[model samples]
Target: MPGQLFCFGFGYTAEHLAARLLPLGWKIAGTAREADKRAAMQAQGIDAHPFPLPDPAQALAGVTHILSSVPPRDGHDPVLAAHGGTIAALPDLVWAGYLSTTGVYGDAGGAWVDEDSPLNPSSPSGKARVAAEAEWQALDLHLHIFRLSGIYGPGRSAIDQLRAGTAKRIARPGQLFNRIHVEDIAAALAASMAHPNPGAIYNLADDEPASSSDVVSHASTLLGVAPPPEIPLEQANLSAMGRAFYAESKRIRNDRIKRDLGLTLAYPTYREGLAACLSGAVSN
Candidate 1:
């Protein structure tokens, strides 16, 4: 099952997944938008190529699995537009995964949302994801959709934000956000690769959906620093993107991944996840 895995956007999540699969004898190759990033990946032994792959067929010659973490561009998926035909023609392609956002289920009013929940996206990015998902589902391939929650791990966690003095405790009463560790996301993806279930939609989130202030405060406690003062959402002086994120809140459900893929998250909540980040205990 570990033949060749090609990732469309080999960024943070894809890098973590590669860390797991590479050790299992899988040949890893992917595209990065920046030449420097491509060079870094190639230096780390990945067969990295630039985005908008110059020769799609030649690059994807022996790929058994494909994962696309690329976001939509101008209301359409770039990967499908560029290489959908070639990918559909691959004879030995076994599984294909698309990393989507749980934001598609926008502003559940902090209510729980599962794979069956109806999509009501409020942001342009979320709407683009809905369209991209439809396009992927339309293709004749073994596809699995992973609607990921806020991904946090290692250098991307609240601890790092606090250390960088960018940790904000914006107060939106009753607003909660769901999060998942990158390692857990990699684990779930690996489990799904082992048990390929076509047409499945899984939510990749942790057990707890907590407020942003709570997460920041916990990270502060771990770092032995005073938590930043909480500012009301309206007075937070956030950018449009930040305000847009604060406007919607939802508690994502992850029962399907556990039931279908038999995955148990290593860091089940922000507390354990931030602790691991502080202790530098991240592992594959």
Candidate 2:
């Protein structure tokens, strides 16, 4: 039978996953915060509706898979709060996925952390994710949680930042952050669907972990332009969320995704990822 996938948040990551599954005859439905975005998705043949799920039972009637990319707001997961009962009661549901951030591992002193790492989220958002993860686990379903690293893709990568002249080389010594290409994220999700493991937690991150300044420099080089001047972490002016990103430094281990799911990343490092984005732009 063809799969019916419903996403709680049809943002960048979910869109990539949907694109991959659509070719395989999957029926995709999702929620958008704004009516305009929902209409836009409907225009593209997607059954997207404004969130808070108007008709929970009706909307999730034939949904075999559920993917939640919505972040916790005010210490609550909107999806669970709104339609937890409806989703739990769905007899047709097989796989349930929640998108989490690697920040849940907190500051690891630049050390390697895996699925077994103790979650000690430092920022407010990270703390909320920890809470949401626990909440989702309480539901009796085939739940699979993914702790994603910094997400970057074609329109949302260092290449775009550098080209837009908004890229900043923030120098934070010993700060190694892991990142995952959006395509790789979609690949991993698809792989999990092929081999469903209930209660499994996977870290979705690239093999290489580098500093922000290094990524900026590499992106500038790819664009054939001088990199932005380096700004020391102490002197850099950043919003609360932005500064919180640098507060945690951990190299996430992705061996579980490879070993268990039998999957390999297409862009294993920032170099390949940035280069691909640049080439893709040129070709387009």
Candidate 3:
């Protein structure tokens, strides 16, 4: 079915998601926070609107599906809060997807975490996300949670960081990291959109989980340059928020997405994603 979809906090992920969904003959609407971005969205020829959650207008009226790309800020998501009951009341809305992070599973010490893993978020952001998910799930609406890994895509890849001299090689002692290209996440989102499963939870991570240093090092290698010097976790200059992310580690599994969605990852690991992007294999 060609569903009418609305994407809240439609930023990077939603942008790519809209590209895929639009082609599949779905009616798509997205949100941009900034007025400048709204104008930019118009220039890009995408129907990106501007709105906040927790008190959404009639937008959810007939929305058959919705994807929330916005993360919880300060324990409140206006969009989700405002429309929780309203959305639940809408019989047409089949699936409501929340793009959460595996950080909710907390620092598993590189242990594997599936959908059944108990949430033990170590960071404020992750805790807020978990709270937000709970709020949505309590709505008695069709809900799905997609726990995303580190996101990378064209123009947002590690090469951009390298060129800008902002790349980090944070050595946090065997801190395993997972990633997924924007396109792959977008494809996975589409698969879920087409095949909506109520209350589904899927981990959207790359097949290969490498250490932080390994990923940056590999990206530098693909670009034919020495990697940025490693900065020990203690010595690294990071904001409280950024540092919080380094405090936890988990090797997320994507078996549920693959098995349920019948999908295969294009970039199973950072090597493939970076190699292809650095080599200009991905089009802008």
Candidate 4:
């Protein structure tokens, strides 16, 4: 049955999910921080509203499913802090989802991490996610947690970076990063909604984990442009956030999503994902 979904943060991944569900006779509504973004979502038939809604109970009166993609601020999840009680009290709520990051596993030294892996986030942002996940789990809702890898699709892929002259080939030995196309993320979320399992944590990632430089080179090849010069990570002029991203080297294992949700990723690897992005095969 199609049910109304309320996403706490209707950003990139959430928008893709909404696109998939809308065609199936599902009603989509969510919160957007910006007025322009809210207007845009409202124009697309979403019951858009600002964050920290003044009356969340009224806004989410008939919502059956909820998804929170909002990251934590200062070690706290804003959504849960503001509206967790109202969400927990929703009489018709069936399923809830929290979009987390694989960084919760921290640096596994390029080792593969599964859902059973311990949380050992290294960065401050990652630590905040860990805290937020804990808070969400404590709530009295049928919640599923998704620890996503690097997200890229459509205008957010390396193709855009290369075209904009921001693509970099940073060489770091023994460093591999897992990534999932945004479309695949949406598919996985939909699959989970179909097979609602409370208290389940799944990793959303692709089959292959490769170096950042390799992805950039492949994107350049697809664009028929010269690849950026390979530079050592130590010498690369990366911001603190970029440096933090490179600090972790672990491959995420996504067996649970397939085994439990019965999902088969359309773009199994970066090759197919990038090709789809280049050909405009996604809904974005």
lDDT of 2 by residue, 29-83 (tens): 9999888989888886789977898788888999999999999989988899999
Q: Which stretches of model 3 miss by more than 4 angstroms?
A: 53-58
Please write out the lDDT profile of model 1 over residues 1-284, one tens digit for every residue.
Answer: 57799999999999999999888889999999898999999987899998788999899998999999999999999999999999999988999999999988888998999999999999888899999999999999999999998999989999999999999999899899899999999999999899999999999999999999999999999999999999999888898867888999889889998899999889999998999999999855
* TM-score of every candidate relative to the true structure: 0.98, 0.97, 0.93, 0.98
lDDT of 4 by residue, 1-284 (tens): 99999999999999999899898899988998899999999999999989889788789999999999999998999998999889889999999999999999999999999999999999888899999999999999999999999999999999999999988999998899899999999999998898899999999999999999999999999999999999999899898878999999998898988899998989889999999989998733
Measured on C-alpha atoms, candidate 4 has an lDDT of: 0.93
Shift in Å, residue 5, candidate 4: 0.3
Those runs of model 2 whose alpha carbons end farther than 4 Å from true positions after fitting are 281-284
Clashing pairs in 2: none
What candidate 4 gets wrong by more than 4 Å, as runs, is none
Q: What overall lDDT goes with each candidate model?
A: 0.93, 0.91, 0.82, 0.93
Tens digits of per-residue lDDT for model 3, 1-284: 78888888878888887777677677877788798987887775566676754335565657888888777767977676655556677778887888988888889998888889999988888899889888888888778898999999888888888988999998888678698898888888888877778888889999988887888898898888999998888888899988888887779888988899988898888888988878767532
CA RMSD per model (angstroms) = 1.0, 1.8, 2.1, 1.2
TM-score of 4: 0.98
Model 1, runs deviating above 4 Å: none
